[model samples]
Target chain A: MALVELHDIRKTYRVGDQEIAALDGITLSIDAGEFLAIIGPSGSGKSTLMHLLGCLDSPTSGSLVIDGVDVSRASSNQLAAMRNAKIGFVFQSFNLLPKFDVLRNVELPMVYAGVPAKVRRERAMAAIERVDLLHRVHNTPLQLSGGQCQRVAIARAIVNDPKIVFADEPTGNLDSHTGEAILTLFRELAESGRTIVIVTHDNGIAARLPRRIEMRDGRIRVGVEAAVSATTPLISPAHPGEEAGA
Target chain B: MNFWFGLLIGLKEISAHKFRSFLTMLGIILGVASLLAMFALTEGVARGMRENLAASGGVERVEINNKDPSEENQDLAFLSPGRTLDDAEALRKGAPLVSLVSPEMNLGNNTAISRSNITIRLATTGACPEYLEVGKYELAEGRMISQIDVDRVTRVVVIGASVAGELWPDTPDYVPLGEVIRINGVPYRIIGTLAYCESDAAKRKRAAGFSAVQDERRTRRMGKKKRVNRYDTYWQKNHAILVPISTLFNDFRTASNADGTPNWKLDRLSISVADLSLFEETLNQVRGVLERTHRGIDDFGFDTREEWFDNIESSVRATRTSGSLIAGISLLVGGIGITNIMLASITERIREIGVRRAIGARQRDIFVQIVVESGVIGFIGGILGLLAATGVIQLLIALSPAENAPVMTLSSVVVSFSFALGIGILSGLYPAWKASTLDPIEALRYG
Candidate 1:
C-alpha cells in the first residue's frame, strides 16, 4: 500500500483579482522506505508539493492520504499532530534552532510531542550517534560547519521516528564533498527502512536516488512511477515508532 | 508545551538580550516603586492624623465657642449673658449625657509667667479639677487645683514642663512645687508640675538617639530651652500653666462689669460625653441647657472632634486617589514599554517561530511562549521594584517629620507586585497574537 496518496490536489492563491495556481492537479504516490526525489527549477510547485507532503499545509482541493490517514481536511492542530507523529522536515538552510545545542535541537520535536525527558534524551542521543554526531551533541549550530549542521538537522528529523522524512535541498548549502557525505547518510537511513523524499534541482542528487520525478510550472513534467516499479524493490514496513526512544 | 517550559524559553530569550530586556523593564520597576511609596506616605499621614485626634481629647469632647448671633436673634444678643460659669453649671445640672463640664478662663496668648528675672511667655488657663481630664494633662509631681483651693481663692498654680524648665533651669530635680512664682507681677505658688509632652514617633526618635546638635540648634533658634516634640500641639500642652478659676476672677476678670459683680463669663466651656455613640445627643442636650442659661439668644456654637476626623479621612482619601492616578499611569507606561519590546522581539524571532511551528508546535504553543516571556520580564521587574521600594520607603521615613513617618505595609507590597506581573501578562496579548498568526510557510521563508 502507498504511504502517501494525492489525487489531483489543487492549491490556488489570489494575487489581487488574479488567481494563481501554485499546485495544479498533481497526483503521486510512494511505497514505504522508497527513496524518492522531486526535481524542478524555481516556481515549479515542487516546494509546494513538498510542503503539502510534510503536512505543514493543506491542499485547497482534492484528497491527500498519508500513512492511511486523510490529511486534506485536517484542522491546524490535527495537521500539527500528523506532522509530529508521521512526518519530519529538513530545510535547505538546516533550520536548526541557533540558540539550542545539537542535542537540544534534536530533542525539540519530542519536546513538542510531550515525550518524557529521560526517553527524549536517550532517543536524541541515539539519533545523534546514528548521524555520527554524538561528539558534537553539546555544540550549538553556529559552532558547527555546514555539513555538521545538516547532520544535526537530520538527527532532529528522525528523532521523532516519523513515518516519512522530507528534505528540501538538504545539501544545497554544503560543498560537493560534504553534500556527498549527507547523501550517503540519507541512503543509509533509506536502507534502514525509513521512507525519504528529497526536493532538489540538483540533477546529480536526483539521479542517485532510487526514484525521481520532475515538475514544470505547476504540474508533473515527468512520471517515473513505472520506472521505479521496474527497477526498485518494495521495503517491508518498519513503522520506526516501535524502536523510537525505546 | 507546559507553561513552565515556555517560561524557561522566555528566560533564555531575555538573557540573550540583556540590555534590551532591562530597558524594557525599567518602567515597571519605577512604577512599582512609586506605587509603593505613595501607599506608604498616605497611610502614614492617615495614621499620624488619627494619633493627633486622640491626643486632642478624641471624638467624645465638645467645646462651646462664641458664634455670631443670627439676624433674628441679633436683637436679643445683648439681653443674653453669653457662655459663662452659670451656663457650665446649668449644663452640669440639666444635661444627663454630659459626663463632665470644664469651664475655663484663658489668660490671653501674651501672658508671661515669670520667676525672679527669668520669664517665659505662653497661654495660661484657669480651671477647676476637670481640666486634668478634658485638657489631657497629666501631673508628674505636685498637686492639682482642688475645690478647697477654688473656694479659698488661693493663688496656687500648676506649671507645665516648659514653664518649670524656664523658671528654674538650676532646679532640675525639684519642680519648686511650694515655691512662689510671679504671674504678671503677682506672686503665686507653683503647686504642680506637668509631665513632658511627646508623640510616639518623637519618643522612638529619641530612643534611637537622634542628632542632638540639630535638636539643640532648633530649640536655641526658637528661644526655648527644652522643646523636644516635633508637633507644636504637643508643645502647647507641655507649656500650659493652670490656676483656679476663682483666682483668675479675683486677679484678672477683663475689667469687672459696670455693676462690679466680676463679669462671671467664661472663655471656654468643654464638655465630655458619657457614651461616644450618644455624643450628638449629649451635644444637643448641652446646647439646650446653654440656650436656657443664656436667655434663648444664639451667641454660642458647638465644636466636636468628629468634624476634624472627617477632614483627615477625606484628605487622606484624596491623596491616595491622586497618588494612584500617577502610579497607574506610570505602570501603564511600563506595560506599553513591554508591549513595544515584545513586538520587536517576536518580529526578530519570526524565523525561529516558523521553525518551531514547522516542528509541530501549535499556534497556542507559540502564543503561550510569547506571553510567558512577557510575564517573566514583568516578574523580574516587580521583584527589583520591590527591592527598590523598600529603600525608597526607608528614605521617606528618614525625610518626613517624626510625627508622620511613612510606613511600608504588607498589602501595598502584594498589590504593587501583583500589578507589575498583571501588566506584564496583559501587555503580551497583542504581540503574542500577531506572532502566533504568522503564516508558517512565509515565516520559514522570512529573513
Candidate 2:
C-alpha cells in the first residue's frame, strides 16, 4: 500500500459570487521512500496540492488517505497529529520563529509532541548538528544569514524524525550555491529511505527528482511518471506553451 | 504543550513590545490600586467607629429610660410606676446575663457645692458603685462611691477633674480627694477624682499626628508590662459629680403624687453585660422585667448604642462594596484594553501562528499561548498595582487625619491582586480563542 493516496480530490474556494477550483479531480498515490516533485505555473493549484498533501487543509470532496487512514473525515486535531508524527515541511521563506534561538526553534515540533525536555534537547541538538548549525544553536533566526536560516528551518522540519518531508520552493530565497547545498541535503535524506516531496515551478529543480507530476489549470498534465534516470537534467521551465505537449 | 513553554512565549512577546504592554496594563494598575486604597480606608473608618463606641461603653452597656404611662394610654392617668429603682434591683437579681445595674437620678444642674470661699454650681448624678463599672469610668486619685455609701445614705461624692480644679485653685490635685465640701448646707466628702478628660477634637489631633508630645507619651507607655487603658484618655468630656442613689432619694426626692407619697423614680438605668454575645439577651430580659413592672403598657424604651455604631459600620460596608464595584468595572475596562491589544498581537503574528501550527501545534496550543500572554500582562499589572497601593497607603497613613487614614491588611492585598489576575484571564479568552481558531493555510498566506 502507498504511504499517501488521494482519490478524485476537489477543492473549491468561494470569492464573493464566484467559485474557483483550486484542486479539481486530482488522483495520486505516493509510495514510501519516493522522491517526487509537483511542478506548475502560478494559479495552477500546485501550492494547493502541496497544502492538501501536507494535511494542512482538507479536500472539499473525495477522499485523502494518509498511512491507510481516511483523513477526509478526520478532525483538525488529528490532522495536526498526522502533520506532527508523519510529515515535515520546508517553505520558501524559511519560516523560523523570530524570537526562538536555533535549538529552541528546532525543538518546537517535539514540544507539541509532548516530548520531555531532556530528550527534546538531545534530539534537537542532533538535528542541528545534521545541518552543521550546532555552532549557532543559540542564535535567533534574525541573527542568521538567509542560507543559515533555511538550514535551521530544515533542522526543525526533520527533528521529529518524520516519515516524509515536503519542501515548497525551498531554494527560492537562496543563491545558487546555497540552493545547491540544500538540494544536496534533500538528496542525501532521500537516499536514506525517507520519502520526499518538492513543489516548485522551477523545472531545473524538478528534473533532478525520481518522480514528477506536472499540473496545469487545476488538472494534472503529465499525470504521475517515473524518471528514466537518477540525474536527468531538465524538461522545460513552466510556461503557457508547455501545456500544448499534453 | 507545557505551561512554562507558553509562559516563555508570553514573556518574549511582552519584552518585544514593552511600552505597548505597559499601556495595555495601565487600566488594571489604576483599578487595582484604587481598589486596595478604598478597601483600606473603609476598613479604617469602620475600625475607628468601633473603637469610639467601645470607648464610650456602648458595646457592653444597655440603657433603659422611663416613659410616662399616660403618654401611651390616654384613658389611664397612671398605670404603673415606670423604670425606677425597683426595676434596676429586679434586673440585677433575676437577670443572670447582667454583670452590673446602675440607677441614676439627675440632681438639678444649679445645685451648689462650696469649699470655704469657693462656691461652684455643678451638675450632679446620683448613682451607686456600679455606675463607675457600667459607664467604664476610672478613678484617678481615690476609690469610687462604694455599696456601703449607697446603703447607708452617706453624703459622699466622686468629683471630676474640672470640679477638683474649681474648688481648690492652690491646693494640690490630691487634696480634693479627701476634702469635705458643703452641698445644700450639708457637708459631702469628695471620695475620688475621675480620670483626666479630653475632647474628641483633641484626641483626633493626637491621632492625626498633630501632637508629638502625646505620641511620645504613647510610646513610653508601650514598654510597660501592665496593659494601659487606651479608653481612659480618649475623647470623654467629664464635668459632673457622682453621689449615691440612696442618698439622693433620701434628701433630694422632691416630686410627689396627690396623696403626698414619694414616687419611686429614676432618671435612667444602665445595665452592663458580661459578654457582648449575651448583650441582646440581657436587654430582652431587662425589657421583660420592666414590662412586667409597668403592667405591660410598653411605655418604657431602651437604647443599645449598637444602632449608632451599626450606622457607621453599615455605611462603611456600603462604601467598601461600591468601591469594589467601581474598581471591578475599571478592571473590566482594563481587560478590554488587554483584549484589544491581544487581538492586534494575533493579527501581527499571523505568520508566526501559521509556522507554529505547521510544526504540529494544535488549536489548544495556540489558545494556551495567547491566553498565557494575556495572563502575564495581568500578573505584571497586579504586581505593579500592589506596589503602587502600598506607597499610596503609606502616604495616607502619614498625611491623612487619624480617623480617615487607610488601613491595609494582608488579605486586602491578596484579594486585590487576585482580582486583577482574574480580570486578565477573563479578558484574554475571546482574543485567544479567535487566534487559535485561525486556519494555518490562511494565516501563512496572510500579509
Candidate 3:
C-alpha cells in the first residue's frame, strides 16, 4: 500500500505584486516500505515538496493523501494532528530544542500528543537506544556534538512510530565520517521496513537510496516507465540490520 | 499542552531572567503595598475622627458661634450684638427640633479655682442647666445650675472630676456639696461635681499637653490599655467646669453690662436634637431662628460635630481615590513591563516556537505557555505585595500615635493580590497572541 500519494501538488507564494511558484506540478507515490530520496540543487523546489509531503504545510492547490486519508482540506490544527500521528520531520540543523535534555527532546512529540508519561518514556528510550545514544539521554543538545544532536533528532522523529519519516539534509552539518554513520543509521532503519524519505542536495547520498527522484523548476523529472523500479523493495525485510555496516 | 506543562515553561522563563523579572515585579509590589497601606491609613484616620465626633457633644449637638457677618452685612454686625441669650431663647421657642438649649458665656481659659492654700486653673464656662445634656455630661451629685440661679445671678459652680480631685486630693471620698471655692479670689459654692474619670497614666504621660489636669495619679497606671467606654470619651470633657452665665455676666463684660441694660451676650449657644438622624434639619431650623433673632444680620455661625466628621470622611475619600489612582498607574506600568519583556522573549524564541510547531504543538499551546508565564509573574508578585502591605501597615502604626493606628483588613489583601494576578494575565494577552500568530515556516527560518 502506498504511504503517501500526491496528485498535481502546487504551492505558490506572493512577494508584493509578484507571484512565485515554489512547487509547480508534481505527482508522486511512495509505497509503505520504500526508502526514497528526493534530490535537487538549491532553488529547485525540492524543500517545498518535502514540506508538503511532511505535512509542515499544505499545498496551494493539490490533493495529498497520506496513509489512504485525503488531507487536501485539512485545517492547520488537523495538519498538526496529522504531523504528530503519521509524519516525522528531521531538519538540516538537527533542530533539537537547546534547553531540553536528549530524553526530553525525544519525548516532546508524544508530550504534545497527550501520550501517557510512562509510555512516552519507554518509547523515547527505545528510539534513543536504536540511535545508540542511550548513554547521553540526560545531556542537553548544547552539550552534544553535531552528529549526536542529529541522532537525538532522529530518535525524536521515530519515537512516535510515524508512518513516514522525512529527513531534510539530516547529515548536512555533520563531519563526513559522522554523516556516513547517520546514513548507516537510516539504512538500518530502512531495512527494518521503516518508510524513510531523504530530501538532500548530496547526489552521492541520493544514489545510495533504494529509489531516487530529481526536481527542476518545481517539477519531478520522472517518467511512467520507471515507476516499477522506484516502487520495488530495495532492502530485504528479513535481514533487518545484517547488512547495515556493509 | 497541559496546564502543568505551560506552568513549568512559564516558571522556567522567569527563572531564566531572575533579575529582570524581579525588577518587573517591583512595580506591582509597590502598587499593591501602597494600595493596601493607603486603605489601612485612611480607615484609621476615619475611625479616629468618628471617635472624636462621638466624644465632643456627639452628632445631635450644634453650637452657635459668633461668625463675623459677611462683607455685605459687616456694618450690621454691631447691631446684632453677636450670639446671645435672646437667640438661644428664640430657638427654644421657634424650633421644635431644638430639644435642649445651653447659652454659654465662656470666661476664657486658665480660670483659677482655689480652696484655702491649694488652687487649680481650669477652663471655665458660664452655662445654663441645659449645658449638661448639650455637653453630654452627667453630674455625680448635687443639683445643676437652675433657672433661679440664672435669675438671681447666684455665685454657684459645677466642677469636673479632675477639678474635684485636685481641690481635695487627700479626701478621695469627699463630695463637697456646699463647699465654697474662690475663682481668682472671688468666692463661689460648688453645687455639683462631674463623675470621677481616670485613664492609664502611661497614655497621659505620652499625651502630656492633652489634659489641663496635673494629677500625679495618671502615671500610676502600669502599661495597660483600657477604654472608659462611656460618653466622656474626650479628655476635655473630663476637665469641664461650669457656672451660671448671669453669675459671670460682669466677667464677660459686654459693653451693655456697665450701662445697666439687660445684658444678653453669650459666647456660644448649644442646641441638641432628640433624634440624632434629624441633626442636619434641626441645625438648619435653629440657624433660621438665630437669624430671625439677630434680625437677618447673619452674625452667628452654626458649628456642628458633623463638619469635623464630614471633613474627616471627605479627606479620607480623597486620599483613597488619589492613592488608588497612583496604585493603579503603578500596576498598569507593571503590566506594561511584563508585556515588554514577554514580547522580547518571544522574539528571541521565534525559532524555538517554530520548532515546537513543526513537532506538532499547536498555536494554542504556545499561547497558553506565554500567558502562564506572565500569570506566574503576577501571582508571585501579588503574594509579595500582600506581604509588603503587611509591613507597610506596621510601619504606619509605629509612626502614628494611638487612635489612628492602621488596621489591616482581609479585603485589602485579597483585592491587591487578585488585582496583581489579573494585571499579570492581562499584560500577557497581546504578547501571547503575537507569539501564537507567528508562521511556522517563517519562524523556523528566522535568523
Candidate 4:
C-alpha cells in the first residue's frame, strides 16, 4: 500500500468574498522509500500540497490516508501525533530555534514525541553526526553559518526516525556549493530507504531528484504518472507544466 | 513536553528581557508590601488597645460617676445631693449579683505632701481596703490599709513609685516601709509602696495571674520621661498616694454649709460584679437603690470597660478595611501590567510559537508555558516585596516615639505571597488563551 495517499484533495482560502483554491483536485500517492520532488512556479500551490500531505493542515474536502489511517478528519492532537511519529519537515529559512543549541534543536521532535532524555540525547547526537555537524553541537543558530544551519535542520528532520521527510527548498538560502552539499546529504538519506519529498521552484534542483511531479494552476500538470517507473531524465523538455525549462 | 522544560523556556524568555520583566513586576511588589505593612500596624494597635483597657479593672469592671446637670436634668441634679458612701453601702446590700463596691473620694490635685526638705504636689484618693483588688493595684513593700485602719480612722499612707523617688531621693535603695510622711500639715505613716515600676517581681506576678494594673507601669515606662500630669485619667494612678476612707473623711472632708451640715460627697464608685453575664441586671438594681437613696432623682451615670473596648475595635477594623482596599487597587494594576506584557511577549514570539507547533507542541503546551511564565514573575515579586516591607517596618519602628512599632508576621507574608501568585494566574488567563489559539500556518508567516 502507498505510505501516503491523497484522493482528489482540495483546499480553498477565503479572502473578502472570493474563494481562492490554493490546492484543488490533486490526487496522488507516495509509496514507502520513494524519493520525489514536487516542482512548481510561484502561486502553483506546491506549499499548500506539502502542508496537506505533512498534516500541518487538513484539506477542505478530500480523503487523506497516511500509514493506513484516514487523517482528513483527524483532531488537532491526532494530527500532531502523526507529525511527531510519521513525518518530518524542513523549511526554506532553515527554521532552527534561535535560542536552542545545535543538539537541542535536533532533539526537539523527539522531545515532542515524549522520548526519554537519555535516549533523545543519544539519537540527536547520532543524527547530528550523520549530518557532519558533530563539532557544532553546542553552538546556537546565530553562531552557525547558513550551510551549518541547513544541516542542523536536516538532522532535526531525521532524528525521530520518521518515515517521510518533507523539505521545502531546504537549501534556498545557501550558496551554490553549500546547496550541493545539502542536496548530497538528502541523496544519502533517500538511499537509506527513507521517503523524501522536496518542493522547489528551480528546474535544476528538481532535475537532480529520482522522481518528479510538475504542478500548475492547482493541479499536477505532468510527470507523476509515468515517473513511477523508477527511471527519469536529468532534465525533461518544456512540457505543459515544465515552465522551469523555458 | 514536561514541566521542567517549559519552566526553563519561561526563565530564558524572562532573562532575555530583564529590565522589562522587572518593570512589569514593580506594581505587584509595592501592592504586596503595603498590604503586609498595614496588617502589621493594625495588629499592633489592636494589641495595645486591649492591654490599655485591661489595665483599668478589665472589661468586667464598671464605674459609676456623678452626672453633669444638662438643660433637661438640671432640676434633678439640684434635688439630688450627689453620690455618697451611703449609696455604695445600699448597693452592696441590695444587689445580690454584685461582688465588691468601693466608694472613692478624690481630693483635688496638688495636695501638699512633705518630708523634711522634699515637697511634692500630688493627687490623693481615699478608699477602703477593697480598693487594692478592685483597682488592680499591687504593693511593692509593706502592707495595704486594713479594715482596722478604716474602723480606727488611722492616718497611714500608700505612696507610688514617683512619690518614693521624690520624698526619699537620697536613699540609694529607698524603702519607705515604716517612714512617716506629712500630708496637708498632718503626719501619716507610709504603710506601703505601690508597684509603679516593672521588676522581676512584676513579671512573675503577670505570669501568675491576670493583674491588669501591671500594664499601667509598663505603659508609663514605654512613654516619655516627663512627669505625668496628675489630672491625666489613665496615668494619674502612677503619680498618686492612697489613704483609708476614714482618714480622708476625718481630715480632708472640708466642704459643708454655713449651718455645719456636711455635704454627701463622693467622686467615683467602682463596682466589680460576681459574673459578667449578670452585670446588666445587677447594674440596674444598683441604679434603683441609688435613685431611692437620692430621693428618686437619677443624678448618676455608669460606664463599662467592655463598651470602650468594642468602640476601639470597630474603629480599628474600619481603618484596616480601608487600607486593604487601597492595597487591592494596586494589586489590580499590577495584574493588568502582567497581562499587557505577556500579550506583547506572545505577539513578538508568534513565529517561535509556530515553529514549536509544527514540531508537535499541543495547544495546551503553549497555554501552560505562558501561564507558568506569569506565575514565575509573581513568585519573584512576592519574595522581593516581603523583603522591602520588612525594611520599611524596621525604619518606622526606629523613627516612631512609641516603644513598639508593627512588624510583619509570618502569616501575613504567606497570605500576601499566595494572593500575589493567584493574581498572576488570573491575569495570565486571557493572554495564554490568546496565545494557544494561534494558527501555525498564519503564525509562521508573521514577521
**Candidate achieving the largest TM-score:** 1
Per residue, candidate 4 scores C-alpha lDDT tens digits across B1-447 of 777777788788889899999898898899899988888787666755666566667777789877775567676666776888888788888877778888887777778999997787887888888788788778888989888998898999998766776676555348788889888888999999887633232334456673434343345447746553343334565666899987888887755547676555888888887798887887888888888888777778888887898898998899789988998889889999999999999999998888888878888888988998898888787778888888878776556423134657788788888978888878888999999899887887788
TM-score ranking of the models: 1, 4, 2, 3
| lDDT string, candidate 3, B1-447, tens digits | 878878887887788789988988888888888889988988877776676676567788877777778999887777776777777778778999878988888765677889999987766888888888777678899988898999898999888776676688777657888999988678899999887443333244357565424433453244344343324455557777788888887544545467766567777777888787787788788778878878889877777777777888899899989988888898999899889988998999999998888888888988988999999999988888988988888888778756677777788778878899999999999999999989888888887
Give the TM-score of each candidate. Answer: 0.90, 0.82, 0.76, 0.86
Comparing candidate 1 with candidate 3, which one achieves the higher lDDT? 1
lDDT of each: 0.86, 0.82, 0.81, 0.81
Which residue pairs overlap in candidate 3's backbone?
B201-B218
At residue B282, give the lDDT of candidate 2: 77
Superposed Cα deviation of residue B339, candidate 4 (Å): 1.7
Candidate 1 docking category? medium
Positional deviation of residue A66's Cα in model 2 after best superposition, in angstroms: 2.2
Deviation in Å, model 4, residue B194 alpha carbon: 3.2
Using lDDT as the yardstick, the better of models 1 and 4 is 1
Local accuracy of candidate 3 as per-residue lDDT tens digits, A64-125: 89998888788888878888888888988988888778998999999899998899999999
- Evaluation by TM-score, superior candidate among 1 and 3: 1
List where candidate 4 sits over 4 angstroms from the true fold: A110-137, A224-226, A229-246, B68-81, B93-96, B168-173, B196-234, B254-264, B288-296, B401-404
